[model samples]
Target: MQIENMVAIVTGAASGLGEATARALAARGAKVAVLDFNEAGARIVASEIGGIAIKCDVASAEGAESAVATVSGELGAARILINCAGVAPARKMLGKQGVMPLDEFRRAIEINLVGTFNLLRLFADAASKLEPLETGERGVVVNTASVAGYEGQIGQTAYGASKAGVIGLTLPAARELAPLGIRVCTIAPGIFETPMLKGLPEAAQKSLGEMVPFPARLGRATEYASLALHIIANEMLNGETIRLDGAIRMAPK
Candidate 1:
């Protein structure tokens, strides 16, 4: 779909991948909305991109509905929905602490998996009602997953399960939404220079980067944004989970 002047909503647009995508969409002339739980960061990014910033929790039914409604009222119906809000909590089911608290696992799944579906349902409902474009497409959704979903390391019980759920959601969602002229796709990224990773010491970051077979560096937010833009432009690429990792099938730690 043509992005020019189209309404686009990006969750977790306060920083990292979502921030990059929001800026990219704005550069392409889309009316972008930066939806995030981080109000201050969202405001900063939205101000820079000339998009509206909305404080929203993607996991809450009321919050998601309100956010979608606000976006529609202010920016018109969103034709692009990018699901980038998630958490990566490293925890072992059993460790020195004995057993990991159940709430920890639930939090990861709630925020990473259920949160994605909450926004998706609301976005799809709104987008599906819009008139189809010349290509018979009404909207496109790009979801974020992680390489850990496929090859989770030692301390990723919660994070891995959450992301794996996202990976599992891709194809079925696309097939079901196909008739509505909306497409769903996912991106499973390897270790990247996200805010969370940036907190690590430079040497530790470098060691992690070297794990990739080639390129031997961390993924960039811009690279992820580039693929997302391409997916939006390329209608044939649906029901797919493209790995943004640089040939890195993670080893169990």
Candidate 2:
């Protein structure tokens, strides 16, 4: 679908992949809304891109509903919803600290899996009411998963499960929303230069980059953004989770 003048909602837009996506969409002339728990960071990014910033905790149903309503009121019913809000807390089922706390696992699922579904449902519902475009498409949703979900390493129990759930949701969601001209797809990214990884020591980051089968470096946010834009434009691409890694199948730690 043509992005020009379309209303787009990007959650977790404060930093990392979400921030990059918001910028990419705005560059394509879409009216973007930057949603995140980080209000200050969201405002900065939104201001830079001439988009609106809405502070939101995507994990909460009420929060997601309120944010989507605000976006509709301020911008219009979104034609694009990108589910980039998630948390990746690495914790083993059994570690030096003993069995991992159940709450930790639940938190990951809540924010990553449930949160993704929440916005997707809300966005699709709102978009369904809009008149279809020439392509008969009402909207599109692009969700974020991770390589860990496919081949989780040690200490990735929680993170991997949450992401796997995202991958599993793709095909079913796409099928269910097809009648409404809403498509769903997922991106399972490999190690990238996100803020979470940037906190690691330089040596550690270098080591991780070397693990990639090719390019021998971390993935760039812009690269992910490019794929996202392509997905938005390519009507045939739906219900699939494309791996944006450098042909790397992660090794279990």
Candidate 3:
């Protein structure tokens, strides 16, 4: 799976890990479509990398379909799909006001889990219609999950459930799509320096970084992108949820 000239669509491409991935893929000669709700940011990135930008709400079925079709038409069929659009909220199952609202819980699932699946289905469909590459591979789909998916701690009811659902889907989806030569995988990140982590005190952020044991710091977006590149290059990495976390197990708040 040489990345050169491959077509890729990266959701959440306006910032954080998605932006890093789009830049990385483009650098390696992949034609990229930067998809994001931040239309202006998407346009900036697309302009930077000579890629296309599609403003989209990845959670919507129609939005996902239109974005995929647009990418397929302009960049050729997409052989790489990266589902990086997600939201994280740290709220207890029983909030201060009382039990958390059910819709709040469901919204996280809709955006993170359902959105990932929505994009995957469409991308796989587009990839399947195209001829296989010389290696007999049709495409690869990489999803983003959080370490919370595995070690959900306090105040993560909605976020954890959504990410956990993503982890649960990886294996079965990979198994079903394997015969068609589409690899599906997930990456569960530990603490990273992304905007989602805003509002934390600098000292708290540093303390969290110190918990990573090995690398002993917050992960960079490029670090995540680097592994993504490897997963795409290696054919046997399917159906697995690789932790990009620096071996940190979150503690209960």
Point out where model 3 deviates above 4 Å: 198-201
Order candidates by TM-score, high to low: 1, 2, 3
Candidates 1 and 3 compared by lDDT, better number? 1
TM-score (C-alpha, index-matched) for candidate 2? 0.98
Each model's lDDT: 0.95, 0.95, 0.93
Q: List model 2 lDDT by residue over 30-110, tens digit each.
A: 999999999999999999999999999988999999999999999988999998988989878998899999999999999
Alpha-carbon runs more than 4 Å astray in model 1: none
- RMSD of every prediction: 0.6, 0.8, 1.1
For each candidate, give its TM-score against the true structure: 0.99, 0.98, 0.97
lDDT of 3: 0.93
Candidate 2 segments exceeding 4 Å error: none
Regarding TM-score, does 2 or 3 come out ahead? 2
Global Cα lDDT for candidate 2: 0.95
Which of the two candidates, 2 or 3, achieves a greater lDDT against the reference?
A: 2
Q: Supply the TM-score for candidate 1.
A: 0.99
